[model samples]
Target: MQLPMKTNRITITKITADDLEAYEKLISFPQIAEGAGFNLISNKQMLGELAKRQIANDNTFGIRVHDQLVGAILLYEQIGQCGFPDEANLEISYFLDPELWNQGLMTEALEKLVEVFKQTSEVRTFNAEVFVDNVSSKALLGQVGFQQVSTVIDPLVGRKKLIYKLEL
Candidate 1:
């Protein structure tokens, strides 16, 4: 399905095999990884694997600004029994190049994504996990109208992450 591009001057679309290179560049930035609570993307091979998964997954998108790849936004469905309160919800994740920070571009992109999700009818709620130390991300989620529901210490990342959810 082709997602309608919003006025953020970026096209939000499904991730394709051809986008591996761009995805790699965006995730390789240390600031981006740290803010998003993930390890640094070290190589193209890792990106290749990521691209392969994204291509097969229905809930991930490649975000492009002015036809140039900028970042990715993921929406993951909960499986089995999970700690989240809602079963019919999507977990939202995103990262952008550090150079593009504080430009209001990501805010615009996220707003457009929320609109698309609301129209798609796949889920009734959207959620995000932000590292507690990541003030910018917390503010961003708040700007998008997400309310903090809880904080969990991610055993894998060993950091306390704030979980925010929005009901559409």
Candidate 2:
């Protein structure tokens, strides 16, 4: 997947082994976990394992500014809701450095990434699920043309989630 998008002073590239360290640092932040409303990270060893798995398949990417990773984005298929690549509906998720909040970097990166996927991949529908309380994320999704299609609940977080779908 040789797609690296440059937009508004940032580049989004595929996740690699070299990116594990930066990813670990980002995941360790309290704001990252709180903003996303979930935590799949506990310690360095676990993060290393997860990064190794992600690197093996290259389904995700590191969002960078001046070659320093500040975030990541993923566009892949889901099993239960829709289907795989055959459905042409990809689940899109992203997280940025807390310090970069209110900077509009994510909106720029996402707009370009979606544009790239629209042209290069079989993706026709982009799915996004943001926690109800995440007003920033909800605004970003809306800014990128994603419409609220449904409301779902996360049993673990015990909060409502806004499900968005963007048709390209």
Candidate 3:
């Protein structure tokens, strides 16, 4: 789906192979990966595979500023997996270029994602899990109307993750 440009001059669009180079660069930074609770990409081959997988899943969106990919916003639905909410719960996550830190670009992209999905998808809730140390992300989610639901150990991230929810 094509997301319209927002007043902040940002565009959030489905990622494709064309974005792999830019995406790889963004994720290769140790700070970016660590902040997002993912290990730093140590090899180009692994990064290539991950990029391809994201493009294939169609759940990842590229955040572009002036036509340059600077970040990615990704969503996961727990509906069919593990038989939990039957796909009614949507989980949101994102990574940004450290150079753009404190710029409000990420905040705009996230709010836009929530706005779009609430109008277009059957998903009942928008969810987010942030590591306990990521104060900025927690603040952003809260500012966008997501409430603190719980703090749980995330096996994948191996850290205490604070879950936030926004009911649409």
Runs with alpha carbons beyond 4 Å of true place in candidate 1? 36-47, 80-87
* Models sorted by lDDT, best on top: 3, 2, 1
Q: What is the lDDT, from 0 to 100, of the residue 123 in candidate 3?
A: 78
Per-residue lDDT of 105 in model 3? 90
Candidate topping lDDT: 3
* Model 1: per-residue Cα lDDT at residue 84: 53
Candidate 3 has which clashing residue pairs, if any? 79-86, 79-87
TM-score of each: 0.85, 0.88, 0.88
Q: Which pairs in model 1 have colliding backbones? A: none
Q: Which stretches of candidate 2 lie over 4 Å from their true place?
A: 35-44, 80-87
**RMSD to native for every prediction?**
2.9, 2.2, 2.2
Please report, in order, the local distance difference test score of every candidate based on alpha carbons: 0.77, 0.80, 0.81
* Clash tally for model 3: 2
**Per-residue lDDT of model 1, residues 83-110, tens digit only:** 6545468788898878787887778888
Q: How well is each residue in 86-162 modelled by candidate 2, as lDDT tens digits?
A: 44777888889999988999999889887887778776889999888889999999999999999988777678898
Error of 2 at 160 (Å): 1.0
